[model samples]
Structures are given as C-alpha cells and as structure tokens.
Target: MKFNVKRKVIMQKNSILFVILSAFTVFMWYFFFVPPPEQSYRQTAQSQNTAAVSESGDNKFKRADLNESDIDNIYVKEEYINIETKQYKAVLTNKGAGVLSWSVKEKNGQWVDLVFPESAPVMANFPSLTYKIISKSDEKIVFEYVSKEGWKITKTYNLSDLYMHNLNISVEKNSKTPFPQIDLKWGPGLGTDSKELKENISLTRALVYTAAKPNKLKKLKDNSEPASLCKWTAIDNRYFLAAFIPENSTDFDKILLSRLDKKHPCSVILKAAEPKDVNKKDYSVNFYLGPKGYKHLRTYDLGLEKTVDFGFFGFLGKIAFSALTFFYKLTHNYGWAVVMLTVIIQILVLPLTLKSFKSSAEMKRMQPVIKDIQTKYKDNPQRLKAEMLNIYKSQKVNPLGGCLPMLLQLPIFWAFFTMLRNAYELRNEGWILWVKDLSAADQFMQFGSFNLNLLPLIMGIGMFFQQRMTTVTSDLSQRKIMYIMPVIFTFMFWSFPSGLVLYWLTNSLISMVEQYFIIKKMRLSS
Candidate 1:
C-alpha cells in the first residue's frame, strides 16, 4: 500500500512539471513570436485621419494673430553682404548675430532660400510667432515681426567685412524680457498641410548651446527649449527656408555662420539681443544651415548626428546600415544589394543552422524513446529527468540546439528589418513586376476605397505553407495554435514595407527548401 502511494505522488509531480514547462513554452511563443495587433490598428487610423485632414483644406498659420507686439521698439539694424564663390553666391549679414538671410542661386539661376531664425517673439495667449522679410537690398533690409511677443529682440550679422568672410552674431541678455521665447522656421518651398505641420514640426534636430545654463539641461523637454528652437517655413515657389531662434539669455546668444558660398548649400541667420549699452567689441555666435547630408553636417564639431533615430533597436540598425552601405557601393542598387546581403548572411550562418536542424531531427527520432521512458518512469519524477538526460547524452543530441540557432539569428533578423525600414535609397527603387517601390506596399489590388497588396497575401500563404512543412507537434491543440500564428503574422505584416515582406518570403522559401533536403537526407541515411 505504501509503495503504491509513493508511486502515485511521484507520477502526480511529474505530470505537474510537464504541464508547467508546456505552459511556459506556449507563453514565450505568444509573447515574443506574435506581433502586436494594436500597431496595425493605430497605423490604419493614422492614415485615415491624415487623408481626412488633407481633404479638409485648413490653413494653420492664418488662424494666428501674427502682427501684434507687446514690447518696446528697440533700435535694430540689418545688413546684407554678398560673397561670391566658384559655385554660388551667399549673402551674409551683421544685422543679426549670424547670417540674417542667405539665398543660393542654382546653376539654373533659380534662387533657393536658406534663411535661419536667430530670434523672434513668443507670447502667453497667441499662437507661435515668426519674422517676415519686408524687403532686402545690397546694404540694408527690413524685417517685420510676424508674430505676437511679450518682449522681442532682433539682429543680423554680415561676414563680408571679415577677412575670412565668416560672420558671428549674438543675442545678449533678456532679464526684463517678458515671456522670453524664440521661433525658427524652415521647410521645402512646398507648404505642409496644417495637420501634418502641426504634428511633425518639433525640434527633431538642433546643435544646442548649453554653455549658459548647464544645470538646466535636465529640465529641457522633448519639444520645448529654453534657449534654441528650430522650425520650417515655406518662403516662396523657389525656396524652402528654416529659422533658428535663441531666446532670453543672461549672456550673448552668439553664432558663427561660415561663408562657403554655394559649396555650403545653405545659410545660418541669427536674430536676438536684449536692450543694453552699446559696445564696440564683437561677440562671435556660431551657427549652421545647410543640407542634411552626412558630409555637410559633420563640418560642425557638435554632436548633431543624433537626429537619426534608428528606432528602439538602434545598435543592430547601425551594423545593418554599415553593411548595407558597403554592399550598395558594390552593387549600385539598394534593392539588389539587400537581397545579396541577405543571401551572404544566410550562407555564412548556414553551418550553425544546419547543426541546429540536425539536432531537432535527432530530437524527433528520440521522441518514441522519450515517450517510453515517460511511461516507465511515470512513478519516478527525479529518475525520469536523469533517464531523459542520459538518453539524450547517449544519442549525442542537444535539446537546445534548435533554440540556439534561432537566438543567433534574431539580432541579424532585426538588423535587416531596420535596414529595410530606413534605407532612403530604397524609397523609389523597383523590384519585380507590380512592386515598383520596395519601400512602399505593392498595391496591386484595391477593394472599394481600401487597397490590398499582392506581397502581404503571398507572405501569408508562404508562412502557412512553411509552418505546415516544419511543425512537428503531434498534439492537435498545439497544431491548431501553431497554424493560427501565420494568420496573425499576415495581418501584422499586411501594411509593412514591401521590401520587408520580400525578405521574409525569401527567407521562408529558403528555410523550407533547406528543411526538405535535410529531412530527406536524414530519412535516406536512417
């Protein structure tokens, strides 16, 4: 009677352990393997709302009172200094701290605006304020306050007189300045829709001067700034302009604007100063306004490169981007380059994956032996683990080999995912038929007002077939759960970039092929 009772207790413990382990495995599969459904819903909603707002025809700027000023009229002077270079002409100014206004005339003689905001006004009750160019000449120009301000200061800097043809400007002190604030604006000549502008116009990049208030850095908000602010403004049919502003300062808001002519491709302007006794000594304020190309941006020593956000998985993204760039140089096409790189990566890691596949096949072969052991040791909980380990060791099989390959591939997979998402070169690149843009969905079919793509459907089908081929689960319930995964993934990836889907589909097909060959060879050997 005692022996029977002990056997029953051990069997119960073994069953419980099995149940817990199985539950844990299922939980991990759901948590990590399944993509979030909320992401799809959010993207759809955002797209719909954006389309609706675009159709509404609302002017965001017209709603604000831009002609009001609450501060006293302080003495302001402006100057325009023209510098000629081999490629282009730059107009530098000393009216503001840096280049108040500069324009680049292309070889086609079309002028592009490269204006930077040095300073402007901000008020408590009004929408954000801006400055508008009233007029400009070779020697002097006038600017009107285009926004409401409690207290405002404005200046311009000219580099023509400097031997180096570089200008430095500053905005010094705003102790009595009420609600001190500044606005900087720039954009492509094409205006943004009010909704998009409102949503996207925040300081995503800036070379902020923290020398004045180092301790206050922690208080700086993501979208708000105490000293410097940047914004985009559409100047004319020919030019996109951006303004940079430095608000109330205990010391001078100094900026340096280099006069490289057309080689620089843009201009920096400074505009701000508190009313004080005039001094003759010149204060240098450094600033830059130009194309966002990596080479152009690197001229400034400040850590301005942080603007490139590579999502949550940035480290992997960096590696992927480096590799993609290297491959792109060789192929001269990003789309083909991505494919080749993926193939190379797969080939390099093939041995590890092959080893893992072999281990999984060994495990599958041992399943019958495992089942027999489970039945025999049904009354011996500790002995069952020992027996199972012993059996695996004797067969020279690793239970975790399959899992290790998957783990090794995960980082590379994520890196490639990021590479595809942000590769600007892939933006308009073509692949096969109906996939004109790798960066966008292959919208080959449309259902009344809603579009369905060929890639997502293909991806779903591929996933289903792949899952069916590889799934070794004998449990009917587990097989059902496994089958549901492909459907979930299909829905999740339906709106992702076509390039990502292409990569996944190609990977799945390759995996299927590999599994087939490996399994067939194993069966033949056995």
Candidate 2:
C-alpha cells in the first residue's frame, strides 16, 4: 500500500512536468511558423578601387560600362568533364566552364543534387558566353576565352576530396581601356525541395556572416554589402548548405544579393572591378556545399556552424549535440545514439529524481491530515494558510521540493527539443524496421493527406496510462482537465520529426521505470 502511494505521488509529479512540456511545445510551434522581422542592410564604406554599384529593379547590379563590346559571337562545341571526389561528384560544362550539377552523398548512400535545376548554372559565365577548356584533370580544371576586342576571361578550379574547394577567376584586358565589371554569380537556390522528404520552401534561406554576425536574408529586397566586411555567404535549407568564403577580403569590391520575385530564390554576386592602370584582375574564393553538421562546419573556422539554429538555449543545445555525436561515434547508428543520449541524461539527473520522489512521498503521507486541516479551516482563509505551514514545518517537508528540482531541469529538456529538431545526423537515419527515417514522421499508414504516425499514437497511449496512474487533485473537474492534456499533446506531436518523438517517448518510459525503482527504494528504507 505504501509503495502504491509513493508510485501515485511520483506519477502525479510526472504529470506536472508534462504540463510544462505542453507549454514549451506550443511556444516552439509559434516560433517555427512565425517568420522573424526583416533585418536592415548595412551600407558601410565602399572600396576605393571599385566603381559605385546600385541594384536595379530587375535584381541586377548596374554600373557604367567602359565601351564594352559583344563577346558571345565566338562559339565552340560544348563538352562535359566529370570531377569525382570522396565527398561529392561534380559535372562541369565547357559552355561557360560552370558547374552543370553537383551532388553530395548522404548517409544512406544516395546522392542529393544541390544545384537548382530550374535556375542558371551555379557558377556560370562572366560574359554569358562559352569558354574553351584550356586544361583538364581529376583535381584541377581551367577555361579561357578571348574576345576579338582583346577582352580575356579565365576560370580556374582546384578541386579537393572534401566539401571545401577553391575557385579563381582572372580577367586580362590587352587594351588600355577598363574592362566591364568582372563578377561571379551563384544563383536561384541551393538544394531541390521534395514534399515526400519533408523539405519545404520555407526552410530555404540565404545568409551572410559579416561583422561577426550571421544574418538570415528573409526580406524580398535587393541589398549590397562591402566584400571586405563579408567573411562568407551561403544559401542553405534545413539540412544542406552551399556557401562561399572569400579567400582574401580585398579580392572583391561588393557582395550583392537579389531576388527577381518572392517565388524565386535569392542570388549572390561578387563583383571586382579592375582599377585604372591595372589591366589584369584576380579573384579567389572557397566554396563549401555539404550537410550542415556542426563537426563538419567547425573545421572551416569561419563560423559556418552558425547555420545550425540551436535556439535561445544554444549552449545547452551544443552540449546535447556533442553528447549525441559522441554516442553516435560508438553506436554507428543515430537512432540508437538518441536512445543512449536519453539514458545518459536520465542518469545524470538521477539524484534530482530521487529528491523529487521523496518530496512527493512525504506530501502523500500528510494528505489525510492536510485534508482534515483544510476542512476544519474551510471558513478562515488566513488560519488555513497558517495551519498548512505548521503541518509542513512539523513534517519537515518542503512545499516546493518536488517542483523546484523539476523546474531546474527545464533548460536541459528544451535543449534536447531544439537540438533534436535540427539534428542533421538524424537525417535519413533509421531506428528499426518500421522507422525508416528518424528525421521524418514514423507513418504506419497514409490515407491521402492524413498520415497515421504510430510513434505519437504509442506516445499518447503512454501518456494516458501515466495520467491514469495518479490523481494530482481530488477535484473532479481538475482531474478531467488533466486527462485532456495527453490527447492535446498526441495531436500536437503527430507531425513532429520521429527523432524528437522518440526522444520524448524514451524519456517518458525511463521516468516511469525510475519512479518505480525510487518508490521501491523508499518502501525498503521505511
């Protein structure tokens, strides 16, 4: 009987935690759906060597041309060259010596193309004309074109086995006249979106790291910033990223951002005009296109890890991610890694769990006497409060004991929620036979637009039993309200990523077991 009372008390405390979890989930829902405010673009000092640049209504950079002539009349047979590396395979075309397509390998051994099919070549023509391949190799490629007017353009690529690669663009003008603005544009979008894979249009956005801040471009406006201030610029979705890092800040004049329409993706343009008396101009940049893993990004030392949004409790989220990856290194499976992470967290807070258990048990022991006091003082509010304090003091029970320990752990709980939702490692990771992808819903059946996710249903059933095990209050109306929370949560988490749902489910199950053991230990001590 004592064990049952202790179990009931502990289960009652668990219900309170779930109440807090419901509030947290609602806040997160609001945060993800509501777009943030637009950021004001910075207009800092421009480079002295370059001409002034302004954005036109068509989302193109406009500058005064110095007697520029048509250079597209010369055409050569277009050819393709394949560059294969350990990390990715890229196809380049001689049409503009630009990237025709680049696909990065996912964990499931599937190639996901990063090039937006409907847009122009990722790094296409500076003059919008063909260039003949001067040199070609597995690791390096070079293309050069010379117009009849003596305007020369050359593109060089030094490939690597990793995500980071080098690109160099040089323009040589034989005549003394200044050449048109030499620029490199990477456009339209990053990775292709698929509804089946849960990739949505809202997840895609362009970002820039400047002045030690990462600014996400969400506004549909044209903006330009000094190249000297930009460390890197990127277009990324929820999982993958395509970024550009200027090797030398002085190599470019301005970094331009533009979008033709709200439906289209933003474009990034790097412009460097040849200074007077200097006939040749060179620009070098490093390109990174791969998954947004924190470990993978931190190696660049350029703050690329900022692309992974860890929320307000970022430090805790980082700790959780590090712990998660540490277990992944041992398990070799992200699904199992999540389970191990959940177990480790529960163990870490075992002491607090025990304290909360004891506090609740003490409260349960005094319930009979406390109820009598309440009935005796039902007419005198001030006397009832005094009597309650007297009983708590005499029993050596802290009124806030059970709740305070749980409150202290809210940040950790939230950190796990934020981290799991954005965890790139969980992408395409499988847990069991039914769960093929931890990053998506574990749908057992799909009826048109409705997806019947089994994990959430199982989770809801667990919550129902958890609430049924204990009554937090004797009031009939309040008990009915408490039972409704599980149903609300079941519907709320129905579409959440399976990895996050798995984490919560594992935590809930572990809490039940921990409570059982704590209750048993308490009974033995008595």
Top candidate by lDDT = 2
What's the TM-score of each model vs. the native?
0.57, 0.80
Prediction-by-prediction clash tally: 33, 0
Candidate 1 has an lDDT of 0.46
Quote model 1's TM-score: 0.57
lDDT of 1 at 107: 31
lDDT tens digits, residue span 249-272, model 1: 333333223111211111122323
- The segments of candidate 1 whose C-alpha lies over 4 angstroms from its true place after superposition are 1-276, 279-302, 311-313, 375-380
Write down the lDDT of every candidate, Cα atoms only: 0.46, 0.71
Model 2 stretches with alpha carbons more than 4 Å out: 1-86, 94-96, 192-199, 210-222, 260-265, 364-372, 447-449, 520-526
lDDT of 2 by residue, 397-483 (tens): 875677788888888988998999987888888888889888888988999988889999988888777665434365466578668
The residue pairs found clashing in candidate 2 are none
